[model samples]
Target: MRLLPAALSAAVLGAVLATGACGAASADPRVDAPVPAAQVAPAAQAAPAAPAAAQEVLPQRQAAAPPRPVSSGGASRAPVSDPGMDAAADGLRPFLLTPAEIGPEFTAGEEPRPDPATPAPCGGPGVVAQFPFAVRVGAAAESANGLVQETVSVYGDEAGAAEAYRASVAGMSCSEGRVDGRPAVIAPAEDLRADLGHDEATGWRIGGAGFDVVMISVREGEVVMNFTVLAAEDGLPALPDPLTVAKAGTQKLLG
Candidate 1:
């Protein structure tokens, strides 16, 4: 598993404060804005999307190209039945650390509902899910530290995953919009690297007012994974670095 790590340093944190990027919107920024016709799943309990168009407008690199098969050695390559996608979630749980590992104040939240049409914090739209099955773990933010969420999707073949990865990389460029009803500015995560190993990966920082959200998207083999963290700008306890979380996730998924 080739994984690029996104490390947060003091200089990066200082820059974020100076920019005042994606702060919460006041009374909602653009109520008249056309919601993506696809209708995003309400983020009520899910991780909110980054500020950018809900639909991906960038030209994806050869989306139809098939992903190269991962070197599986001599093992047989037989796909197994995954009813209701529970097996997929079970496979990913080991990659993410528990609340106890993060801190005593943290508590686990319910599994996130599948959001088919929401824009990803680092990636654009729901391109990650090329096949019908996907699973998500919602944000767990009972603690004052911050909120964290992750989603994983299995593509039927490598091409879908490759396409999704291409879209995510394209989103690294900056864009402004109202995400989940709040004003936001999304741009490349220059402070933290997005390419955490493997074929394709990218990161983004969506900042606003006194709050900030960081996201990383990675594609390994036939899997597309996303990790996001949101925290208050100042005060309270220090939040977990989203890059570390994403690295760990890709390691587990690809190793």
Candidate 2:
């Protein structure tokens, strides 16, 4: 082989020596040193994840109350049964007539064949009687000859009064009608008995004009009172007004 240049030969020799030195450092315990705690890299630490966002909850809603019922006329109505009647009777006794004051001889009869053209005591075309009876505090009398008429009798007791009133009306030609604002049986009659409620009697001989009649008999306290009314053959044009007047008069006389 030809001789190499001095520079190349020297470079090759230095590379070989460096390689040998590196291999020796790796293999030899004396040349290698242990790694220090500070020099060694520590394991990477993971940061805590951010807290999850809080959920929002809504409150539950409550139910509403029901509505009340209304009437057809928009008015509140009263119950059919009432306890006020008995109470009123009890409180109003002091103002009523007693039975003793009303004499037993009171009678209801037709005027005998009065002149047809002449006006009657009641200021009507026919002569009809206004029978009188005693009440708790006042006296009252009623005539016959109206659209509806009434006759009354007062018995010693309530049962007697009711019976007499029913019987007297039953014999007459008229139908039932309310009396003293209460449902009652009315009839047509010329005379009525003086008992509990017999204002309208049978075989009444009156001038041809017909009349409607009402009868009432009330037993308040120790008194038995009778009330009757005679209305024109025509129904009372003022209905309750006439009845009211009759009732007021009775109360005044009896109480």
Candidate 3:
């Protein structure tokens, strides 16, 4: 995704810092700022509407087949049931939702599955999921002077997955660990900016700037999904928290 350049003259910088400090306390950093009138490219389009939920099937006994007619005068016919076709169809049903329909909000740029023939990405080894929501953002590095690239993944969950994700993200700056045991890394945004100066364009405000980046993951049955937000930093002025806005956007997915 492309980052748009916001006007950041000295006057704007001073106002941003003053306002940003007050924004630090809010749940989302972006909320304080008016939602930009211009259409910022959405990380991705809203997902398409989902198909109607599948209907439940009841158990039933198979009927016995009648004997076949003699070949000499019989009409040609084919069996209605095919186990192989049924299995293939069943395998593909879960992945039918398009990426937009899979989540409330997501980033752009879908990766090509290792196997193009299959709709799903490669499963098993190094596979985060048959399908996963991937969002990318540019954040400040440890110095706060430069930018770093980060990717967040949303996945299907089982048990202990949410806690595990939190722990994994917590260990990111200090340890070599991965989200869901896949090779990845994370660093606290505040810690990254400890020494460097803040810039409005990069979305880092110094001193009174109270922004916080939080990692959130939710688990429902078999789905474990993760996302991040920059929260409103309290003690400042009117800047909105980025995290809070992100959370509000993703919360719709739970419904």
Candidate 4:
């Protein structure tokens, strides 16, 4: 999902920027390319003939490319969601969190749009590459015990949904750093029970520097769904279970 909203308790650097280690780790040992027997035979036969002036060439390693932001419209296609996101409403409504779900004082905020006054994670391509269509809605309250929740729905083909899922996992796995000067850390969920996505998922809790947040994103057939809930550290009722919210939304979206 996008990072925390401006209403976020902490004055963070925001969210989703510098968190975890970038690449995956491996344990296999590097092997050298084999030399032609005939080429090495003469050198072996002779007393290691005087070291040749020409040096043996080695394979060069290429640098890993940075994650490219997903773009829209090109020579071949109009855009991911070329026609528009008209059909996205049905898929997004289920995930919308209501004021009742939080506290009575909390009221519905503005619906998430392409360019909202507050920085929101509504862009499909940025978070999940090639997610042609997406929509989001949020709720907020300014009472002493405040709360914030944003639900995002992304629509695409099966492959697009999978790509989004992978990105979310990486985001949570590697999330760590300071936003707006407050510390942020994302730890794997200890008990995520939702039965959504390709396989069971690793839930996430984002907190530190007075911010309390929980997030989860899942993929089903052709849609990727995300839910994030936040509240001040000293708030009354604690943040509800994110997975529960996700399951409820998935049922409606799929139905």
Please report the candidate that would top lDDT against the real structure.
1
Q: What's the lDDT for residue 203 in model 2?
A: 24
Comparing candidate 1 with candidate 2, which one achieves the higher lDDT? 1
> Each model's RMSD to truth, in Å?
13.4, 58.1, 24.1, 22.3
Please rank every candidate by TM-score, starting with the best: 1, 4, 3, 2
Q: Please, what are the lDDT tens digits per residue for candidate 4 over residues 22-59?
A: 23222211100000000001110000000011001111
Ranked by lDDT, the better of candidates 1 and 3 is 1
Ranking by lDDT: 1, 4, 2, 3
Each model's lDDT = 0.41, 0.23, 0.21, 0.34
Per-residue lDDT tens digits for candidate 2, residues 37-118, read 0111111011111001100110111121110100000000111222442233334433333322322322322211112232
Given candidate 2, what's the lDDT at residue 192?
24
The TM-scores of all predictions, comma-separated, are 0.58, 0.24, 0.24, 0.52
User: For residues 192-235, what per-residue lDDT tens digits would candidate 1 score against the true structure?
Assistant: 34346766566665543334556566666666666655554331
Off by over 4 Å in 2: 1-226, 238-240
- Candidate 4 — which residues are off by over 4 angstroms? 1-83, 90-95, 101-103, 113-144, 178-182, 189-200, 234-237
Q: What value of lDDT does candidate 1 attain over all alpha carbons?
A: 0.41
lDDT of 3 at 133: 21
Scored by TM-score, the top model is 1
